[model samples]
Target chain A: MTEKEIQVREKQEVQQAGEPTKPERYFVPPVDIYETDEDVTVLADMPGVAKDGVEVRLEDDTLTIKGTKGGNGGEGERVLLREFESGHYLRRFTIAEIIDQAKIEATMVDGVLTLKLPKVEPAKPRKIVVQGG
Target chain B: MAIIRFTDRPLFRNPWADFERMRREFDALFQGLTGEYPRQVGGTVYPALNISEDADHLYVRAEIPGVKAADLDISVEGDTLTISGERATGPAEQRFSYHRREIECGRFSRAITLPTRVNPDQVGAGFVNGVLTIILPKAETAKPRKIEIKTQ
Candidate 1:
């Protein structure tokens, strides 16, 4: 069997119109979103970000995920070759109303964050017999 | 009296900014000199590397999320360091419809040439938060030595 090579992607700098307050550069983390029968799952890759540095917020149908990474390399050490830059991770998605906001859960492991948003169950159909008045 | 000597190059340096300009020149010069082209002018290489050096050791780091330590393989042969690993996701039991699939999971390997010779026996590595850091001690022959001045 032939082995597949994972393609390399440079971190993309986040650019939002009319939002100039953020001075430090933030990168758009690559994510995978999937939906099963019960809930939707989101997996984002944010390396070098510890558990305390990650924050997930959901408000007004918008879900935002942020991760901050500290500076790398030691003092007095000179860089020889650099192929990537360390920065904060930011991404936002518009969540549907069918999701159950109270049951959303998030967990991070080895710099990858996994979020689960459970869908609201639809009301079951009921049969009713009306008594003669 | 102790004599203090300063190097010619400035201490505060940013090499990445210069590398971008130098890469373009080297690409153009190589194409002009030889009809065959090397790698792409501006393209992403797999498993991006950040190499840094101090007086004693050289550090190499790579960001590889969702890769387990058991799946990774690292080797140092002479002046070449090879990093290979596989990123495995959840099992294929539950089939779910994907809305947006950007993260790719597969096997990848990259070999880097060290700028200076290193002692392969004394190399060390660690993985934390999906980032792999490797420390290689410089060989004795490659380290700088100061000569003593003798007056008769």
Candidate 2:
């Protein structure tokens, strides 16, 4: 009726984009990478992703993270204004050789992926003791 | 003979405008929200979100990671919907200095005005993993209806 009414709502409903046309969309999860005394921890914000749907791989010096989140939408549900489009999360970081890849640990809680990259023995911080005079 | 200095920094290249530098800057945009939740939009906070509406319901979904469900508090009054929660910053153990901290963790609250009227009594929400979904069904009178034309 009025411009205000039309402005509030979208003119038309947006149909869900199905595969066979456009490829899957990937979003890089927000991440915090910091190194501690003994480990390099990376916290990635990946909401809507389940623990089992996530995959972490370390090959060579590259560490890759992939997660597929489900349950953003349902069948027969017409989307009017789409914002949080559901899809896959992909991010890869080039790691240094000093990291102990074998000891890398990953934990997912409340959609955040916590990756702990333990440092090698030589890379860990070692305090030197001074002899008393 | 004059000695030439080997500098990896490109000559005339402004560090501020570099692609990687710009991205890193963009990532840090939300780092300003490392405190209590403020009551303003674009204040730059964690967990980007999307609010959309359909004929029968208005939907709001927010990206919240590493936050427990119990820590989240969602409420709706009138046309305003608010999602407030806290995300633990890091591991309990004290770690080393931060090489780079991009992800924001702390108190965050987002209160937005809905595009249409909804029944507060019929509001439904779901928190799975880290995504919080709020489904507010439109009031009966809010839904649009089709009118028929009669033949002579």
Candidates' TM-scores? 0.81, 0.65
DockQ (CA atoms), all models: 0.41, 0.25
Model 2 agreement with the true structure over B11-84: per-residue lDDT tens digits: 78666567865764564354435421222333243345566666788877776667788888988898898887
Per-residue CA lDDT of model 2 for A43-99, tens digit only, reads 887777888989999887888898877756644454443434456788888987478
State the DockQ, from 0 to 1, for candidate 2: 0.25
Q: State the lDDT of candidate 1 residue by residue for B27-112, as single tens digits.
A: 54775455322233233657888778898899998998999888999999999999998988564736898888888888898897
Model 1: pairs clashing at backbone N, Cα or C within 3 Å: none
Residue B36 lDDT in candidate 2: 15
Q: Which candidate wins on DockQ?
A: 1
Which docking category, incorrect, acceptable, medium or high, applies to candidate 1?
Answer: acceptable
Q: The CA-based lDDT of model 1 is what?
A: 0.83
